[model samples]
Target chain A: MLAQGVGIVETIVVLLYLLIVVYLGYLGWRRTKSAADYMIAGRQIHPFVMAMSYGATFISTSAIVGFGGVAGMFGMSLLWLTFLNIFVGIFIAFVFLGGPTRRMGHRLDAHTFPELLGQRYQSKFIQVFSGLVIFVCMPLYAAAVLIGGSEFIATKFGVGYELALLVFSVIIAAYVVMGGMKGVMYSDALQGSIMFVGMIVLLIMTYSKLGGVTAAHQELHAMANVPSLFKGIGFKGWVTMPEFGWGQAKYDLWWIVVSTIVLGVGIGVLAQPQLAVRFMTVKSKRELNRAVLVGGIFILIMTGVAFVVGSLSNLYFYKHETVTGKIVAKTENIGVIAKKKRALEARIPCTLLHIDTNNDGVADVDVVEKGHDVVRDGQVVLPASKLMPAAEVKDLGDGMVEVRPRAVAFLRAVVQTKDGWMFNTDSIIPTYVTQALPGWFGLLFLVTLLSAAMSTLSSQFHAVGTSIGRDVYETVTGKHGHGIGVTRLGIIIGIVIAVLLSSYARGGYFIARATAIFFGLCASAFLPSFFGGLFWRRMTKAGSIASILVGFVITAFWLLFIKDEEARAIGLCFKLFEKHSLLLDKPNWAVVDPLVVALPISIIVAVVVSLMSKPPSEEHLRKCFRGV
Target chain B: MLGIESKGILAVYLLCIASSVLCVVYGLLSWNRGETVPDDVKW
Candidate 1:
């Protein structure tokens, strides 16, 4: 199959979309006259705008591209995450947390999330610490989002990864530095709507192409029992949930599905500074109440569709499997042709080494490795690249012998396959979109993904910048000189950091998991303080500080030392443990996520420490919980 | 284990769409009725 390139029509559509984004940035710049306007859009955003911006920022290229790609590998079990996003990210966040955050934030004249915590506790230390954490840790989350966008661009447009990263980051940075929150929100609304529509179309197209949901799932379920690399980790297919338990009895995907995918991202939304700040963007609790449904629906479509389409891409590849053969190679034809020829052909360049077994006109082919016969049922069909450099044919006592290529070895096909679809799960969605959709519509979908990335990136840059300028610099120095300018400068610094980090974001790092880690980290660090600070009258400054520090440190330590994935990814103390984690059997330590452990610990720390220390002053408690 | 019922997936789809439509309708109806913000309050 030929990989689709951006044609003139697609290019025109994307150029037009860019023009609109520039116009929206101009509008945001015009409205952003003061520091207040820049930070929170003057705290009077409409329900629709607030909801759209929140949903857009909450779901980024990570959710669509990264997590969606995960769905391709893992299947519909990820839909549980969509449920969590709607329930916790929107409903509980807006209904339970949003009102108090807004009321308290307004009363304290808090400009950022850290500032709100600082004033609530009457401690500059809390503010600066929170800001420093954001400044340091947020680049990881931002870089994940950056990679999500750039990966799509690289795959879809055949652009260089570095070039893609530079282009998108610069485009997003341009608006965020100029327009601030208003600009971010404006673009977010536009992008959110595009994402919604694009996902809807994608979903419809996927189901229709796969002969509806039932048939598609049935076909997928038929393929469930394939051997997996993880011990005791064979898929039960696309639709079924992995069985759950503790210690050794759990299914292989149990820890991943329940702990990492569900709890990590689900609970993590509560503490996300970017999404939490949206509650304060609006004027009242009523708007939040109204925004909940929109947010929920937007989340459903964005995540639900992505996940559905992602999983269904399996069917797409299965029906149109790339490495096709059962071909008998002839001496005259040294190379095999691709069985399923679309556009991009399989790039495995295997030449048939002929042997005359019977010495007749017919060539009897038998693939052998290391003096052993590598034939199954009188036929040999293997992926060409896997056997390379290590494979040598042995003398089979027969009339003739030969080996056939996996598929046609187009130059472009070389990069798209290793073994087959299992390795390139991340590219499934991009490949599906380019192949399945019409040229004009595929371009639109590409633009929609770009919009998702930009909206989320803008919000991240704004949040991180505000943290640096307001929570760190101004609080420490007791100076608010050119606050907006300082925040803009912070955005520039953030972009550079994110882009640099994105270069290291190679390998098969799923965007959703990366985003989930950020959320988990945030939840551990911030959820305890946020909950205690908002609701508990006896919450102490010491307790809040302890909770934040413990949560942040423990989660980071767990990722760096305990979690095999993060430890290995960063090469930091992954070898410290006899087992990578406490859960399950040794070696392949199948276990719970860091968030599941750290969040509870942080909460307990906050409660115990608060009990041990003096209660918060009456005025502080009243200010935080006044109208709630 | 029993497979995920197709009906359930359909229900979820309907529920998501219905809820979204409800939110937009509710917001549109109650937009101007919410507590009005003072024009010049600097947050």
Candidate 2:
């Protein structure tokens, strides 16, 4: 746990922050008088607030802790994602889509994103289906944020995970359900500001600790020759892109990094319901235009600092010596050696053991021994016969025997450490924060993480509520102008679902994968239809319906059947096909994200279907495109 | 540049900063261009 023994300071700071947040929620609740106010902040939100809300909701703990951890493992190649976030997410979104979306939303008298599309196409089915998709699919994302934040709170404050999850959900639910969009956005502005400041400090501290920016990166680059588990799968170094090639090993990392991490969330931001609805929160296109500046800088700082600091953390870990356990046996008996290995494994916090064979204090090989076989990189490098007499020894041919363990003790080097636990990539930022930075910064960073989580969760809950009240319930029951009660109820239900999912889902990459799943799903399901509705006047109701349905089905199919991470988690592909992914036999297809496949096909379908069907009525088009 | 050896990574790193500058320029240039409210709008 980070910030241990400083619980009093952290508690006071966290309590004060929560009080301010709740007060802002109360202010929003007091101001919200009508459906418009509750739904879209009366469509008169300040440009700064709207932009910050949009950014805060867009970047969650998933971006900082989850994706930051990814940066730690994959290195500065993730800077491409930071670039896309600023260019595509902020510049393109605000400049190209923001004005049109705002105009069309107002002209059509639409409140939510689904309502905009539904009113534009004059199809209640579009609204209801889209609402259902968001309500159903968004919980996974909310859970990711929930888990990320709760984990931090639990560790920082020494609370149980369950208690942290419950408290986190309750606080977010209270605000979102009461204040609605106004509360969500107001709180988001504050949280976003904190995140901005926190990230800046983190970057400055990191560079200073590592000498300077150039020196830090150079040190990371120099450590590229160090033995790493990812080296087999095309990882070259921390400062460079993964080795690019068509071979299976190289192509896998490239696809996962470029397609999934960079492009998936990059393009996916355009169609996020929580984010797009912010365009409608503003009065004029000028606000959206003005927002572009703030949004760009905010996103750049948030993602850029995270990725840079994450990559640089490698230098810190390499230079610092962590607690390690050394095991030796006087006798070279096979049974006695195996028993000693088991005891050593029980003592260590990590599963995959790394041994320093040459006594240089650096780990030479990461080995997973099964019975008498010593495996490295999934191959039996030391056969049972080799392990029989020598107790795991390899002659280096340079007169330096690389002995694992025989008559002498072998030094084992654990990776990074936190509270005596072996640190994985997910723990990199947290470990770095607790160990390297000043204790005061931990309090601020904790608040930053909480703010990130709560801000995003608040918007997600608000989106879910509005989806149910405006799109699903109204469309289904033919009710109009009366949705606040149902919306509040929906927020509660959404919070419960998220809490439940967070409790059940547990893994090393769970947070990152969940975030990517939602982002990729949103891109596949919403991007084509949303883009077509905005720019193309010819896009018809049938085209949108077909695109949404096809995009959704294909993405779902890919997640359940092709993507190894999701498929194995769901266990559906394994149940039916007896494989983690159906494309396990096929090379890179399994790793290829659903967004890459579904989004293009969805776009093509939208174009073909819109062209083939009767174009939208000119009168309707004029009404939708009134101001733009 | 920036102590990064890979040209690809260096380009991306530079582009991130450049794109933010581009956004700032665009936002400043167009700040007062689109403030007109549509007629017959109700609030």
Candidate 3:
């Protein structure tokens, strides 16, 4: 098929962004003075950077690709979760958690998140436990992100999806390893801005393309059985409703919404090594307080835009899904189509902008890792400009103009009809980005996404390196190693691991979808330990260890044995555990969202164990939560 | 999550506005950046 080509302007927008990011990293490198500079920007990130970093770190491909895709499949009611994410994840986390952590960190002279935990408890074991948790769980989140970005790209681009995954993962690992936290925060600020604008652009585009908000509501409401099937919320049989009170709701979307996705990342953020370090990076509490409002605004914009656009994805998917009768993929290819239109031939270049020149619809083929359909647009104009026109092309004004055959035909059709305009229902943010963006707005969109991806990737590397070096090394040995050189090596090791994991992601959107469930597991294990450590002065090492171990073990049992995704990710290993499942009605246990069960048990264990042993010293208790 | 208490909603808004304006004017006219910061302020 003669592929639909993208416009030069779009390509420039995306490619130019890559150049800018590399340039920023180079700038950060020049400012790098000492060990502290590389690790924590010499403990002097401006409030603006800190605020944006907190917001940027809070969201990733999981928000844009995975959770958003799930929302597309479901409904807009999940938007409440976005509100929760901002209030709890960004606001409370910063206002309540950051200051105490930063203050304690300063007192303890600690650098990493796990180090804070160890020093706080006056226990080497606690530090090791924290490190172990990060080491084990971070891969899941990282893999999920790698998978999300790759999946979006793969599905948008026509080439091998795994190859696309390799491309993005390598680029992220490269820059992050080189930049460190200084580089990460700077990039994060820029990326957070991109995500904010891009998402708002997307929300506007979705509603506009759907013929405005009222029209979208009408179209969605018009779905024959929607009202009867999902009567408001809280309906028992109506599994689609927000199933809160129905405690044991298996991998049900509602439970995932209220308990897992929002709670997992939200609660887990409080404990994240990468995030806690941000508090220590700032100079003073005034900066922290000032950043609070700014952070709230940033998150409100970042997450709010994501959730709003994510909700709109349902409209696009609803349109495509209910074309005839059956519920087709409750997602759309609007983003995909918009992105492909950016490429000269829908071939994803380093950068691309607003429209997909190739009409498969979506902004520049979504990050090529996620498998995508190379849908054929009705004849491509074959950009006369890209082809050099067999002569000097004359009278070509600025913006995208349909002149040649295919583009002319497509343009004529666009001019002729104005009925159905849906962003691609696919989960990638491109759908919203492309549809929401106005003319000449794509360059901004490119910068927006570029920033989000880079920001999250830098933090991931920081977490990975910190865990491996300070946490893992200190756990095995009794003392701190050379700080700067160790962290540098850790950075290298972290990048290598990311590259390896990206290369290994075999399934198409496996990483993207797996991320939410993985985050749920992180929540199940950590929320108890973190909360226990902070609140319960009586929590003992035994209780903490047992709680974390049991929490994770139960989570694993539920995921592999409990969930009904045997078909989604089929494996020979399932056969080994299938009949051996100690509890068969596990999915009934609401296995994916285990914190509803594990957290209480973890709390009980900690309290019981601490009582059995000597309570922590009062001074330790005071210092652990001092100044807050 | 941003749910405000209905009783003091306008009062809080008024306070926030008054504070914001005060900060803005102080920032614009302040001679010393460090002096502008509150004594107890951490960041």
Candidate 4:
């Protein structure tokens, strides 16, 4: 259904884009002759390239498709994340952390994030441990990005998932392995530029389609009472924040939206190793300073546009009407009825259908149908099957049969009336794009998503490769000069692992959750130490090590045993505790993100351990903080 | 403001724009301030 109007125009556009991307990778390879060039782009990258590369890598397809879909469900409240993304992700990251990181990295001659930490703390254990965490855990995040990118390609072009995964991985791997950081950043800038233009056009078109900005918001605000399940969990209106309180259902939406979605990503951006590594790629503090301006605008557009467009898409769906009807069966023979049900099931998109089988007042079961739209008489018809067990058929004699009248109900996408089917939130953006936007814009948006995915995957693969080659290999093998070969191998391995994981990982919400898990984990494990390393003179190697281990271990423990979303998905808590979460009995603890608990404890551990242990020698401190 | 009734949501919306403007102002003001060569380049 998504590939309805796609044709030679999309094919040519994608091919042209890929050709240019490969050319940029080749250019990066030509310019790269040394380890520095491969690892950190020789520390001479222009401000625009670094800024665009950083923004593009930071906001992946997860931010657009996954989180944008979330906005469609939750409303404009997600704009808080956009604010944080610009303020903390770009401005503070570039201003506060970027300068010190660049200066210190230069002074230490560090090539990677782990290398910088290892050299600063003068601990090989820190380097190896950090590298191992990245190499092992980063694949989950990379796979999420891979899944998002390849699925779009598969759907847009009608290709197999495996083929799309293979092709996407190979294109990124070729560039990342050959050109390294330079190749990744160069292509990232190009991708970022495309994404910027695409989002701008999307915003303009969306607002225009909805009769301008204020009118669109006003209409969305007025549709607050469109009854759905989200209303029960503290959703007030699209324009307002969810009702804020604690205990049971009172604050479930608030915690899930603010703590998990907003804060988990907002605060977590500072410590993302893949993003933090970009700050060290620039030549001087001036580059980082200049980067903030471009970075802020870039991030604002990327995420801000997505959130705004996502929430407004509901208005589009609400206003547009397809065919709405009640299903009536004509045959009552068991075999004939079964065959008809199967046929209908094979021809409808996966939608949530609410039907009341019993004579009670409440709907009993939710029927999810996964297929294509069933078009009859030039109108899309509601498809029914055994999936809707509540629907009963009766014989009216004379070879005619009919479904019970009570079982029949009208259906619309996402708009749940007393009895209607709802569209999957994940399908909101794609459906809106196909149904609302011009055909040309759909092609542009697809390219935008591809760029978002590729840019992020490149940075992730680069980080994974360098962590192994520069940090782990050098620490383990006690060899320094042969990083390029090992780094290329690491890139291949990383790509393979991501492709494998992408093959298995399914569902829409997984993209956003997997990304959040990685981000929250990184924030807990690395934030305190990273922040202290740059700003604190008293931080010691023991303190940093203790903080890293505590942060990582605590976050892992919470994700496995306490956090409901992850713990239930992992099933470890269920097996061990015989419950979905260890904190299932607790009011709001199960929903509170791991970062909220672990980051504070990590900071405390860093402080206490530093205070208890002897401080670093004056000479080492001076060496680490010379330029800062 | 902007047809969004909630002050909290409006604050967040405004902050996103304000932050970007702040970054521009900060970048322009500090563009040349940190360009000096380090006194000690030796590792």
Candidate 5:
């Protein structure tokens, strides 16, 4: 297979790049004269490094593989989320969240995200608990990233999934554990450059393959309304939009697209730990300023390229397949049936189907399971045997609606197996990448996959190590101030655990689900206190604690209890020893995009709780509020 | 986006330039420390 030969050469080049990264990490390790150097690169990094590091950390494997895939499934509307990511995730996050985090980091001499939060309120419990949370959850997130990377390599390079996972995970773990944040940042900048070049090249190649944008758009437009069970609900027979009512065809629903993709990711970007640390790395506000321009340009290109190419995937697929029924299994006649069934029957994933055999809102009741149980009614309901008609849900004058079941059930059956517009919920990136790139170009595309996965995994490992070494290890042993070497050991432990979790992980959308849960929990606890501590002078320690605790608990409850169509698609699980959840479906938050509901609640609780609690010391307020 | 349906790569290039300008302007406005940003936390 000369194709395989090209792939092998590509792989070797990538490995060489990785080796250089590991060497940079070693240099960072050697440069470490103190804890600060290891953790924050002595807080004296240049703006260029800061920007690249921020970009690298932000564009995890989730971007290229997971969300990019989603764009393949949905149409390009997910591109709006990419725009929001740049504006909110980067721009607002940098201007709004970055400055204070730096000041707070310096004031408290805090190193990690947990340390910043913990020291802000003078609570060891906060630090330890926050650390524990990151340690415990980061692996799941890390594993998901590993899975995305590994899956891509297996798909594109013809490497075994297990082998790819091990190789990629091991490389990242080695660098992160050995290098620390500086190593991570240094490698991130390099990886980020590759990512930037790779994405641009990918976009060019994608367009070239399709003959041009006009041709691509022409082909894509043909599938605009080919045929679907649900037409009135604006189901453009495209996977990008959900089926609701006349105004909701493919990309029509402003709320679903804005709420789930835009706000969920956009706002959540402010609170991510790995990305936050980059703010603290730069030498001064000047460097931060310089980074703003460079980082903005880089991100715009990276994300813009991803969206443009990803949206054009429809064209590539159409060119390749030439079947107008639309390759998005969800848009297919049958896929429309599944959504109809799920909506009408109320069969969410946890149960594997919508039947209320157990009658609990939890799809917890499964009739029979295939591995993880694709659908459950306390019995095996074979997916729809044939195409089902789409149901029309008509608007009754004033925002009211009624659904026709037989038609809905027909669409649901097709959707159960065939992907349609709703298929953008997951697996879209894989489909598009495979279709868009051919031969060496495809192999080059694999570099994007590899870089994304490795960078994300590095952050996961770094967070895991930092959390365990400082929080769990210190807390359980009641030991304080262990040397850096000891913490490196803790990092090793976290990596091993992450490897195990990823190896056994099974979800079509492990990355999105894991990211949602991780960020949701982070937002619940951190967003409230982080903002309050910086803004409200009267925010008390008692209020902060209450807000964090309340936020964490409520968000978890909502995710575990509430069931929504978006959530069911991603799936969810809990605990270190989680059994195969009989209910394959998860709540909307399980995809776990947190900002939609979790954020507002976090803010409200923090404000209210702070008002009702003791205020921080006047001195503490002065330190936090001095510059402003 | 005006007549985006009709124009081709030239529109894309022009749109790109306009976008960059907006981003630069936005970054400057936000970074201007002489004025305080709403909800910005000053530590």
Candidate 6:
């Protein structure tokens, strides 16, 4: 109910954007004649198109909506991810892995990551197993992206969440099922360009509205306070890194800043299947080389702008809003006051009740009286013994304290609620657009968000479908002839599964959290096997299978068991074992992610198991390692 | 000297923009080094 719009001009613009997207899908479908064309765009994509598609797929509403919203709550500490996205995701991924992946995939004639592994090792088992894992686990990720987009639309149009999700899912699914990889990439390129323009404009507007970069951040710095839950880290501490330590308060900050946000996401991007296949879509090493700058700039504009604007939203809210309690009038009747109290409680979202203690000019103290308090005309009374001091009012001694309005609102609207501050974080970006921008631009920005979600979702659906068709069905049935039909069926199935999962993918969760979770899962499951197959001559078939299986199992175990909140969400914690996380009790290292635990285990198991077994045959080694 | 917050904010913008520009320059400079498709790998 923030701001609803169905203006004629905005509606026309949205409809026009959708038409162009559908047309692009049709163009891709027209060009896609064979399985290869459907899967990898016939490996003839231009460098710019490849880079844009890769970047567009890599960044989605996860970065812009979920992470941006989080930035509003967590402050600028999240900017470390921008550095990692460029350096690790774009530079290392394209420069170090891109050329070799393209070469090796070509050498093996591999259409998918599972197919690549299966071919390199000459093992149908490795291919089918990897494909099964992708088919099963990828829906969680796709669902997260779906929710990110649908929620934004729901907020913008005042539609129900279910209806918004269905419409967005069906539209993206139509293009993905029809166009395949070629259509996905083409639409991705268009979307990426749109996102770039939208984000740059957004960042400029955010700064201009707040009076400039320095002024905005300075205001943010002033507004900083460590909420009670964080326990130790103050606002300044949240803004900066904790000095390296395992001590109580410092570890909480490090756990959040480093273990979860930075490393879990940063290092995890190297092995994403959707991103890896992008390298194979283009022709040469030079294409990848050329793509580096384009991808870097695209990501910077997409993610950098999001983080900047997201954090700057705090300044906007501070200047424009105040949290107000209902006005109390002087009266003498206890019965009328009791009735008014109940009405006020029902009316307001805030829990705090303001009472004029001395019947003075200004209403004196704000008390969060849960179930008991006497409100009478002119003055009110609460049991002095039970009242704990409100943190918003700092005691300056002499029975006097200064009250901070923003701080009080923060305490009431965020901390005092059952859900934490991050509960409202996901809505920040959309709310900003609707409330802050002009009407026409808000509609345009909505298009940018839809493009972000659709481009990524299309890529994900295509990747999952191709994995099932090529790696599982084709490998099992030995029918490479009817591959396109099988893949199209797989696309539909993937969309259905993702839609189902998204219905359960809500509740105070940010899209970026789900994104990072999947990235970490992929890195743990695929990195050891993929990197080993590429670089190590002695990496045997048994070793690769063992590594992949172990990595997948460990990542699943950690996410569904050790991460208490995630475990509870999945209905796995109490039913399967205990209700609480195993790591929740371990205060020093509770913030460490499953990827941290799983990746090393996968690598070690792969290396040790490979060396213990017989080396791969000379012919296999020559084909895989030397690309003979 | 500028405040830490100002410097940090500036760095985020500069780093992103600089990295992108450098990439474009490098790509343009090396554009001619790419070989045409080899016969065996031609799609």
Task: Give the per-residue lDDT digits (tens) of candidate 5, residues A1-628.
Answer: 0112233577687778777988988987888787778778888886777888888778877777666654544445555666666666666777677787777677666778877777778787877877777777677767767767776666455556678777776677688877888888888888888888888888787777767766665655566554332343334423234433322233334444455555666666777777787777764565666676767777777766765665566555433421111111111122221232222332222111222212222221111111122346676553332222223334444323332322211112111222322222233455455433555666666676677667667776776776777655665676766636656876777777877876775334456556655665677778778887767778777777777777777666555544233234324433321422323243222222445566677778778887887778888777656663
C-alpha root-mean-square deviation, candidate 3: 11.7
lDDT of 1 by residue, A330-440 (tens): 222123322212222332234333233334433222221111123468865543433321223333334322232221101112122222321333455665676556666
Sliding window of 10 residues with minimal summed lDDT for model 3 chain A: A408-417
- Candidate with maximal DockQ: 2
The superposed Cα distance between candidate 4 and the true structure at residue A534, in angstroms, equals: 0.7
Native contacts present in each candidate (fraction): 0.17, 0.78, 0.00, 0.68, 0.06, 0.36
Provide the overall lDDT of each model, using Cα atoms, as 2-decimal numbers: 0.71, 0.79, 0.54, 0.79, 0.59, 0.72
Candidate 2 Cα outliers beyond 4 Å, as residue runs: A321-424, B36-43
Q: Model 1, A173: alpha-carbon shift in Å?
A: 0.7
TM-score of each: 0.82, 0.87, 0.72, 0.86, 0.75, 0.84
**Model 4: how far is A262 from its true place, Å?**
1.0
Candidate 4 vs candidate 5, lDDT winner: 4
Question: Which candidate wins on TM-score?
Answer: 2
Error of 5 at A612 (Å): 1.2
Model 6 chain A: lowest-lDDT 10 consecutive positions: A334-343
Tell me what TM-score chain A of model 6 achieves. 0.84
lDDT of 4 by residue, A281-341 (tens): 8877888888888888899999998889888876775553221222222212111111111
Candidate 5 residues lying further than 4 Å off, grouped into runs, are: A1-8, A228-234, A237-256, A320-431, A472-480, A564-595, B1-21, B25-43
Scored by lDDT, model 2 comes in at 0.79
lDDT string for model 2 (A420-492, tens) is: 3232345557766765687889989999999999999999999998999989998889878878889889888
Which candidate, 1 or 6, would have the higher lDDT against the true structure?
6
Model 4 segments more than 4 A misplaced: A321-424, B36-40
> Which ten-residue region of model 4 chain A has the weakest summed lDDT?
A334-343
Tens digits of per-residue lDDT, candidate 3, B5-43, equal: 222222332333343343334333431232111122232
Candidate 3: tens digits of C-alpha lDDT, residues A1-628: 1112236775676677777776777767777876567766777788778888877876777676666654544544445556556556655666567666676676666677777767766777767777766766576567666655654454434445568666776666666667767777887777777777776766676677777766655555444243221233342221124445444443355655556555655555665667778988876676676676666556555655555455554445334311011111222222222212111113211111122344344433211111123334865433322321111112233433322221110111110001222122234344434433454554564456546656776787777777766777756675665555565566666655665666664332344345555555656666566666656667766677677677777666555554444222433234675442334344444324555666567667766776787777787677555554
